[model samples]
Target: MSIQYVGLKEIKGSLIILEGVTDVAFEEIVEITLEHGEKRVGRVIQITGDVAIVQIFEGTVGLSGSNTKTLFTGHPLEMPLSKEVLGRTFDGKGRPIDGLGEILAEKKIDINGSPLNPVTRKYPRNFIQTGISAIDGLTTLIRGQKLPVFSGNGLPHDQLAVQIVQQAKIAEGKGIENFAVVFAAMGVKNDVADYFRRSFEESGVIQKVAMFLNLANDPVAERIVTPRCALTTAEYLAFEHNMHVLVILTDMTSYCEALREISSSKGEIPSRKGFPGYTYSDLASLYERAGMLKDREGSITQIPILTMPNDDITHPIPDLTGYITEGQVVLSRELHQKGVYPPIIVLPSLSRLMKDGIGKGYTREDHPSVANQLFAAYAHVQEVKALASVIGEDELSDIDKKYMTFGHAFEKEFVSQGRNENRDIDGTLDLGWSLLGILPREELDRIAPELLDEYYKPYKKKGSDA
Candidate 1:
């Protein structure tokens, strides 16, 4: 059977109704060839009877009802895979944008596929030390895990992303060859594009990196295809090529907005202030694609970053992402205002895989104790800040006063660090001890004295007395 666009009829909204296709699978990318010889692609967003709902990828810029032939490739969009993909740049649809040349792909696989069985996924139990102490020391990222970063507008999340790429190191006992990075940006600026290029170039990792950029000015419809294409490439490299891949997608909010826009064009019912009701499942389809297969040496670990509109963590994008991903690295506006770089609000940021990735062979033996004590101490510090706001610091109980000091020290010493600073696991564990030292001996209930004796040192460095 051949695809011939018989006629086009205006549907409910911006969507164009096409007749003549009896059967087409869901989300299949259709190629449309115009009389003028220009070729464009669209997706089979919905189907009813012999009529198909095709959302134009580049939008129907110049088109007529006649002379347009639609070809349903009978498959969803797929990305090309090969080692040659590394350090190359591509547009939203996986076409190379770096201008060097297109990849001579060995094969292409459908982007939409069943997720790895939860039970079959190897538990992520190793940390990736991204040199920034704020991350390695606090909300550590684990390999084979999906831990997102929730940020706000005007925050330095991009800088943090750049820093992670620069500083993130392999877990001990793993060779550098076992690690790789794949970055996908949706609706970002040209300057942002240049920054990543320059940073990777400076680090000399552009060769080992692969970038898929969906710029703000590009067709909004293309945004939806960008991340999936990126992930498909990652899966090929990690699972097929046997290379460990770290996938980072920034501003997922843009991705969601594209979904909503397409939903509106389709005249579908909206949910949560005009967002499509299927958003949760759609996000799940993308996020659940990450992880290490039990039998595969190479794994895909995702760190998706998004800025909550108006700092609303309850926003549909961040809220839904929280449900599907393993954990989050939540940012804080309050902390940002206080001038804490990286400003990771440790109380809210967590890696559910932390337990599996810490202790013994993975990291320092005291890693568990150190993380627990820092978390507990900082939590109490929040309480002290609230109490001090109600009553004077002097009026508070003695223990409350210690909590207050610990809180300040946690931010100034533990959380705040330079962008270039990189801390190893031992240094991270030791730094946690340094911050805990400000509290009196009795306040160290989260950690055992034996552990403390092994790790703890007074905050004051030894002077010339040596």
Candidate 2:
């Protein structure tokens, strides 16, 4: 039996420091008893020469030395793994907040599980259609890759994340038949948290989703452990249960803040802006864990979402994340102010693994051709706008005039969709063709003859109103 110590050390704000403690691991949960016989819970966060710092899960109040007892379970925080975890609301540590008792789980997993060995990882080669033309047709999401949505202050990162999760689905003929999403929110506000809850319920995706939330009001140390705990659960689902899992983590900036705060508390030498020097390596350790395992039936795809501080991409958080992740979907604050719901600035957004995901068997054979044409047309449109600023629009060449028309038409027809619109591949491709119809076939250098024959819009005669 574990001995219960009656010596509760000094209460420094929200933390309780105890001396003469032994055998306590970082993040190990402990049961705390107050003098009034009320019980609470906490975790051992720091170990310093027999001095153990325990952070209370609930705020530490009315607990003093010589009147409290601390018992260590000799175990770190953990979560239950099972299919029943879906559609349930849990705390940052995977404990059910919906009035449910402890889950009779098959396995007890540590939150800080070891990273996936890179040598055993398979190269990712496939597509996951979000059913949104702006994403699939423009910035295609490749299966088994880590693609983050890079946003700035006042951007619609949350809304875009919701749309992606709501519409994301495995390709029609891929090996994976069913997929599930494990979404974890760290340091998010209550309203933003509610939006996700309502969105998942409305889309009926709750049944296939496992959600863990650490709100802004939660303890700072818990915020630090939130992502690791969520990722641990995802690893269990994807690796152990052989399921296709998409793990979405939002507001990573908040996680970094918590890291800096803890590092400051520990009195570690600071890197950039009081961040630990190993911040890059630490972030890589998390993002790199997502990928396709060789010869395994399951794969882990990560869509981590983080907004840049002050819209500065050079911020350490996004800069480090950029280095670790595959590609980025950059959101535009200007576009958000323009009343675009998603506000994804297409020019800067890209999916590096687009080639592997789109082709004859997976998507339409003309997928790449259409994407190239759209990109070229959009670039020309930008050029036209810039030239129109210098020289008058009335003096522009006929080709430039048509390019301007195509750009506006592309944004209105292809990019903008209803709030709940989930377009299929064929529908998205058809929209591309319709937008290309604005340009004459002679000017379509991006498309090949075969693609032209396959998806060409009927040509219009000269001087005919199209």
TM-score per model over all chains: 0.95, 0.90
* Clash pairs, model 2 backbone: none
Give me candidate 1's TM-score against the actual structure.
0.95
lDDT of prediction 2: 0.82
Q: Write the per-residue lDDT of candidate 1 for residues 1-466, one digit (tens) a residue.
A: 7555645765433356786577788788888887788998888888998778988877786766766677888778888777899989898899998888989989988877556778888877677878776677667788878889999999999999988887666775554676778899999999998898899889887888889898899888889888888898889988887777889999899899989998988878999979999999989888888888888888888999999999999888989899998878988988899999988899888888888888888887887878888888888888778888888798999878877777887787778888878777787677778777777877788787788777766565324232
| Model 1: ten consecutive residues of lowest lDDT | 457-466
Residue 272 lDDT (model 2) = 91
Best by lDDT: 1
Which portions of model 2 show Cα errors greater than 4 Å?
A: 1-20, 37-40, 44-48, 59-68, 173-177, 458-466
Name the best candidate (by TM-score): 1
For model 1, name the residue pairs that clash: 87-209, 125-357, 131-422
Provide the overall lDDT of each model, using Cα atoms, as 2-decimal numbers. 0.82, 0.82
Residue 86 alpha-carbon offset, candidate 1, angstroms: 0.7
